[model samples]
Target: MATIVETAVSAGSFTTLVAAVGAAGLVDTLNGEGPFTVFAPTDEAFAALPEGTVEGLLADIPTLTSILTFHVVPGAVHAADLTDGLKAATVNGAELTFDLTDGVKVNGATVVTADIVCDNGVIHVIDAVLLP
Candidate 1:
């Protein structure tokens, strides 16, 4: 299996995500060893943001990096392991809250796809971009 970054690139729907990761210089981090649970947002999710949000973020490396890392947790937490009200610490140092009560939400984005196993981690596709 490919790494999280590779997997997202292959999925094709995450073009914006892939580009953001690159611009944030987190491609190597996501490609590193050990498990990571990423709430991968699709291109459409990024598009849903207010106008100019994406461009503004892309221009700020620190902020962009923080937002990207906010989508990732330290370990590979599968869907079954998620509880109704669970909060996990993200690499960005913020806690990502889970609400399984309504189809599994991270922060505020709903999980559209879960448990996409990668070589060194997992990816859970989210509908909206989670903010930290």
Candidate 2:
């Protein structure tokens, strides 16, 4: 399998996320050996943000890193292993609650795609970006 960066690139919906990762200087960290579970927000999700939000966040390195890390949970959490009302801790030190009873909801964002395996982790596509 490819690394997290490669997998995100191949998926084709994480372009904004990839760019944000690059801006945050977290490309190497995500590429490193880790069993991270990332609730990756699609490009559309970023687009849904209010005007200037994305650009503003990007200008603030520390906040950008925190927001990016909020999408990642340490360890590989597959769809099957995720419970209906699960709450998982993210790499950013925040807890993301999941509601799988009606499809899959991570934080407030829906998981549109699940179980995208990567060499260092897994990616679950989310429809909205989660804030810190």
Candidate 3:
């Protein structure tokens, strides 16, 4: 099985997210031994942002890091662990509330794909980028 980074890279759909994680200097961190639950946003999700938003974020490492980390919750939380109204604290020190109604939602984004198992963690694809 691949690590979170490898799984995401192999998928090809998370190109922008992978790039942002690299740009944030979090490649090593995410590769580290972890049971992290990453709420990964797809390239389409990133593109959905307003004009130049991604560029602006990429230029700000600290802000980018915060945004990226906000998508990660420590421990390997699978889709089954997420019940309606469950809230988890993110690695960035923010909280994400899950709404099971009409599909799973993390903060303002909906989970498009879930339970992407990685060697060290799990990835749940989201349709929108979650901000802290």
Top candidate when judged by lDDT against the true structure: 3
Cα TM-score per model: 0.98, 0.96, 0.98
Model 2: residues with Cα > 4 Å off, grouped in runs: none
Taking the tens digit of each residue's C-alpha lDDT, what string does model 3 give over 16-121?
Answer: 9999999999999899899899999999999999999999999999999999999999999998888999989999998999999888898979898899999899
Which scores better on lDDT, 1 or 3? 3
Ten consecutive residues with minimal summed lDDT in candidate 2? 99-108
Model 3 spans with C-alpha error above 4 angstroms: none
Between candidates 1 and 2, which one is better according to lDDT?
A: 1
> Model 1: per-residue lDDT, tens digit, 2-109?
999999999999999999999999899889996899999999999999999999999998999999989999988999999987989999899998887779898889
| Each prediction's whole-model lDDT (CA) | 0.93, 0.92, 0.93
Candidate 1: lDDT of 53?
97
Model 3 score (lDDT):
0.93
